[model samples]
Target: MLIALISLFLAGSSGGSAAGSLTAAGVLALVVVFSAAATLAVSFLLSKTLLRGESSAFTLELPPYRVPRIGQVIVRSVLDRTLHVLGRAAAVAAPWGLAVYALANISAGGETLLSWFCSWLDPAARLIGLDGVILAAFVLGLPANELVIPIMLMAYTAGGCLTEISSYAALSEVLSGNGWTAMTAVSVVLFTLMHSPCSTTLLTIKKETGSIGWTAAAAVIPTAAGIGLLAVLNCIFG
Candidate 1:
């Protein structure tokens, strides 16, 4: 979703499809790698500090190696793991998508609540090297990471649905018209890496910890890091 949204905007911008799509894909790759590393580091620190516990040791013995059963492996992989993950993802995504769609179309006092909310957040977002629409996308997309780009496109284009821009050139034009720059893309990639996990992940965390406080910490810690990191970068580079 992030790559699609960014690529669309870049394609619409000055360089055309080739440059814009390539840059967007490169940024997306960076974001994925950085996010994984950051998440691991944060998890380690949290485990040592806030989630600390007395250490325990266990010994393992290797079993005699044998060829695994192919049918059993397929069943376990597909039925036990893949289906479970898909179910959780679907549960989280559907409602949030509906809510975002409504927010885009629903209006109060001649303006959408989505636009009003974005405007309210614009200043703080700019401070962190992002704009209101990007921040709003993050917030509204909490339920699923995949929703972020759709939310951004809807917000930027003021479309009733999670509308597609059809071509990269059109996407670039929309993004340029909305004041996107390379810095904006960089900030977005960084923020996406450091921001809180999706709602499903949070739910899983809460389930494992069985504590709202820890779950809240899980959300806040990464967000704080992202904000601080981006603010520093923007100050130095902007």
Candidate 2:
């Protein structure tokens, strides 16, 4: 019930996709898997903290489940958080986008030094499960998460005009021009999906946690996790 309501709120507020077409079992399976993992993770951490390296116990709560106020929930999740994140994202993205354009365009000898730097990092980047172009994407994408895909597409162009990807064939050819393979695609997706959010998300974290430490942790933790995972994958599949 709560999940359905939350989904409805997200959809109504921001046109966020709701799981409308899924079979009942599929949705339940997703909720069950996600809930189990989150529950176990919290339980493990709390146990370690409370046990002092000894025995630990856990108690589960199952509320009788009463109807919740629609207005109250909408005010909290929809009107409040959606606006907070969106507003902060726009604030961060505007200046950050301009900065990124400057950094990416300001050139040496009629071409950007950025591509030169990407070349310099190529070997090291390859060893760590990426390429020179992917390294470039990472640097240029720091301003906002949304730019990652665009920068990556520009990298694929390799100093040429960016093209609209109309089909899988065109996508493959572009990637192929940059020496991309399945491994590269997999690694890129993994890294981008797991990496840090835009500056707005950072601000949101600060507000949500009311602590700079937790906000910083929120930023650093995912980054470290992504890098570590990529490093391991690179080592194994490299």
Model 2, position 17, has a per-residue lDDT of: 32
lDDT of 2 by residue, 60-89 (tens): 999898899898989998767888777887
Lowest-sum lDDT 10-residue window in model 1: 8-17
Clashing pairs in 1: 12-172, 13-172
> Which candidate tops lDDT?
1
Once fitted onto the true fold, the runs of candidate 2 whose alpha carbons sit more than 4 angstroms away are 1-83, 159-164
Q: What is the lDDT for 228 in model 1?
A: 92
* Superposed Cα deviation of residue 227, candidate 1 (Å): 0.7
Q: What C-alpha lDDT do the candidate models reach, one value each?
A: 0.81, 0.63
Model 1, 1-238: lDDT tens digits are: 4665556543345344567667767766777787788878877887798769946466899999989999999999999888877788778788877888788889999999899989999999989889999999999989877777778888888888876666655766777788988678768877877889998788788878899988998899999989999999999987
The window of 10 residues in a row where model 2 has the poorest summed lDDT is 2-11
Backbone N/Cα/C clashes per model: 2, 0
